[model samples]
Target: MALAQFAREYRTVRRAEGWGSLDGAYYRHLPFQDLTGRFTDIWRIRARSYHTFLHRVLAPLESLTGRPLNVVDLGAGSGWLGYRLARRGHWVAAVDLLDDVLDGLGAVRHYATPVRPLLAEFDHLPMPTGHLDLAVFNASFHYSTDYAKTLCETLRVLRKQGTLVILDSPMYRGPTSGMRMVQERQARFLAKYGFASDALPSEHFLTPARLDVLSTELGIAWRLHRPGLDWRSSLIRAIGGIRARREPAQFPVIVGTCPS
Candidate 1:
């Protein structure tokens, strides 16, 4: 058997026995029938964490843009951040793979329109060229099976001098050592299409080091800002006026700018 096939079988058997932390829910339901409810349930579980990330990350961009900005929440799961940003008076677009999932987010004030499904593959997203001012990947970058293609597609839709931000996503490693399971599953999913896993480097997923090099190669200026696990993000709704933490720690936001 091929390595990807082997990995898939191993993951299936492992998960059937409840061995890994990787949730098998998507393995069954995803890229299939409507999955709105499942997406909503998962996002609700992480609402607080999302709130913190949105506040810290969007706060500064809001200032830099000097007005309510044109923002796209790429891979926007359940539309939480888009909803929050729209409420704050920004023109937000919540794009996702499944139309039903985007529909599930419900009414969002100040948004340009109802949630729109991109429907295109992540690596080949179908947004118009040079339109969005800010694009965000909030803990959802891992789903793109082709990281480089996805990044290129993301950059394609960004306006000159625009910003692309990724937050709260680990390069690898997940709850219960799920990286191995993730690797196994993706390999299996891609094998039938005649695409071998070895065609690209496994390191395409964004890492701090990789992001640095990608920015330079792509001629984009970038910064690594971690709000120290406690720094209050200005992107949030400004709770109790809490002050940013003083200690240095790994925070979430990795902001980069497209050259004008």
Candidate 2:
């Protein structure tokens, strides 16, 4: 059943290029437009669930790390999470590939905390080494074409004992399922954009075994957390039982810590 749904989603993505091009050509021209609206509408339920989960994750971490910690929100879309962290008294650097998207966040006017917006890619962050206390990839890490290199780059920017948190992305129980997602994503990108199958951005999902290997190779301590849904998610899960049951391991928050 999970495989069937996966196949169906692959076909759906193959059939249409729903948003602007990957390079932000379409959105860059429309400075005043709310480009994130369509994306938020599509992933409305998941987004809400992630938002709740983030708050849950942050509460404890905030207490552990103390206030005014330096944070980097990698792949920050509209800078929502960054803004939230900043508002909680943390200094946040919101980084994304699309400058227009960052500009659209209106962080200066909307957020009370200092939110520094940066236009950069995952593998090539323009940040000083060992400076950040936390680096968050909220539903954004899989966009990297080279996950290993990206992780290494993340390590370079994080201070000793800093945390890397990955949330809201599909995580597989094993390699086979993870590779299946990667193949389907590649096929969809190839069909939709006429690009090489390997060229797709933000399509890879992680498996626990693979993550273990990464943690070992990078010398970082890691742990995985299964996020419990709030009432809203519980109700949605009840109505979408079959869909929810299809992949129990799909969404989880994986944390990696830089060893002191």
Candidate 3:
């Protein structure tokens, strides 16, 4: 099993670096149907902490709304989070770039409240204006090339006072640190893959200053929350024993509410 997993990772690396025909498609199509069980196992490990964090964030929103939420899960990947939310009786729309990935979720078979899997991009969500009670970008917001445009679109689709949550994505203290991290990631990718950095999807970390500007421009009140380290994360940190220099806050949950 270990050998097979190593082989799979090697192949994925090759694909990501453009050395193989897959050309980063393997990573892009993650959390897909995994009859072999390997993908699911990996996802379980990575997502466990995220799931707990998400539930904590959702609890207050659920209580405040006092009814099933009209929730849109932007960049929802395999839609597991949407499946869970749907099972809890919220009306969930799981939007992603890949239709096949969404279809594999089997939301209808698994949940009573069917999860609507929509193929769409973050900047141009195909939903009615002022309809969504909540919009969540779980580790997906950074993929946007234009963060401001995406935030504006998110606000447009949200109802008055609707909540927008950005979870499990990196946040920097300032623009300088954020740009430095971006360049470092690009450099690492180039070194490993021997391809143009753009071969992999573009991603940019958000900074508090940038968010503040966006919030003021859009007239939305926002707050940033750094998650407390859970057992899983703690164990990972202990094993790794810290890396190079990093911003004060890494993974953050940015919550914004559209003004009435």
Q: Which candidate ranks first by TM-score, i.e. highest? A: 3
Per-residue lDDT of model 3, residues 3-76, tens digit only: 23323443456345332112233333333433434445434443543555456667788888899999998877
RMSD of each: 10.9, 7.9, 7.9
Per-model lDDT:
0.54, 0.65, 0.66
| Candidate 1 lDDT, 1-260, residue by residue in tens | 34344334433443343321122332223223223353432333244445555566577777777788778887664455676666677777776543332232222222343444343345666678987888887566655665556777888989888888876554422222234434554676456433334432333245556566677668778766544322333323133112221211123566778787
Give the winner by lDDT.
3
Candidate 2 per-residue lDDT over residues 127-212, each given as its tens digit: 99999988999667876766778889998999988888887677767656566556664675667655434524544778777787
Give the deviation of candidate 3 from the true structure as CA RMSD: 7.9
Ranking by lDDT: 3, 2, 1
lDDT of 1: 0.54
User: Judged by TM-score relative to the true structure, which candidate is superior, 2 or 3?
Assistant: 3
- Which ten-residue region of model 3 has the weakest summed lDDT? 19-28
Q: State each candidate's clash count.
A: 5, 1, 0
Clashes by residue pair, model 2: 143-202
Which structure is stronger by lDDT: 1 or 3?
A: 3
